[model samples]
Target: MGVLFYGSAEHAIEIDDVALAHLKVVIATKLRRNESFTLSWMHDSGQPLGRSTIWLHPSIELRFAFEEPTPPPLDPAKIQAYANSANTSGGILVPEEHILGSSRGVVLTA
Candidate 1:
């Protein structure tokens, strides 16, 4: 599992390492262009049976930490899917499962 530390140092979201890798690419691209967007995802089991969304901006303190020292290979399809979603008004909505192994499918919101 990888941790996405956004804003507050204590605020962290645990995600699959591979999924975070794909998302990192898309997020970096958007932030490099000074674009701000939202990222939404379904809550994990044991949590509230709902979803959550967060605003992402270049100025915000963002950090991604992986349990593995090396990052796994990134999938272009997944990256494209994330980028496509991030380009939308609703930004990127991640599946509760790992993107590379999940069947939930990529959903883009306008």
Candidate 2:
């Protein structure tokens, strides 16, 4: 598991490392261009009983922490899919299946 610490440490959102890695790319790209967007996702724990949306901006602080010391190899196809979502009006909707799916030949570091 990985945690996305947004705004502050107290506002950490749990996500898998693969998705976090892909999200990092899309987010960095958008933020680099000073583009702000809304990112929504269902709560993994279902504590919120629905979904949560956050306004991502260049000025906001974000952090991605993986359980493993090393990062996993990224999938270009998955990255492109996520990037497209991030570029859309709906913004990014973390693809759970793609994130937790089989690695195929991709090696994940512990």
Candidate 3:
């Protein structure tokens, strides 16, 4: 499992390492261009039993932590799909497998 620390360490969101890897690519690409967008996901478990969305911007601190020391390989198809959603007005929705139905490890802090 990987953790995505957004804003502060206390606000860490746990996610699969592979999924986080893909998210990192998409997020990095958008922030590199100074773009801000919403990242939405459905919370099937946890305190919130519904959907959640976060505003991702260059100003906000974001970190991706993986259980493994080495980073997983990147999938171009996944990156493209994520980038496409992120570019849309609605922004990017996480649980990326839903976007590409396809299928990693590392602690990448950004």
Question: Which candidate should be chosen as best, given lDDT against the real structure?
Answer: 1
Clashes counted in candidate 3 amount to 0
Model 3: lowest-lDDT 10 consecutive positions: 101-110
Candidate 3 error regions (>4 Å): 95-110
The reply for model 2, stretches above 4 Å from the true place, is 45-48, 96-110
What are the per-residue Cα lDDT tens digits for candidate 2 across 1-110? Answer: 77777896455666667777878888888999999998776544335345677899888888878887887898888789878888899998764443322222211211
Tens-place lDDT per residue, model 1, 12-87, is: 7777777888889999999999999999987554454567789999999999888789979888988999999999
lDDT of 3 by residue, 1-110 (tens): 77888886445666667778888889998999999999887654334345677899999999888887899888888788879989999898765234221112112221
For every model shown, what is its TM-score relative to the native structure? 0.85, 0.79, 0.80
Q: In candidate 3, which residue pairs clash? A: none
The per-candidate count of clashes, in order, stands at 0, 0, 0
Candidate whose TM-score is highest: 1
Full ranking by lDDT: 1, 3, 2
Per-residue error for 102 in candidate 3, Å, reads 20
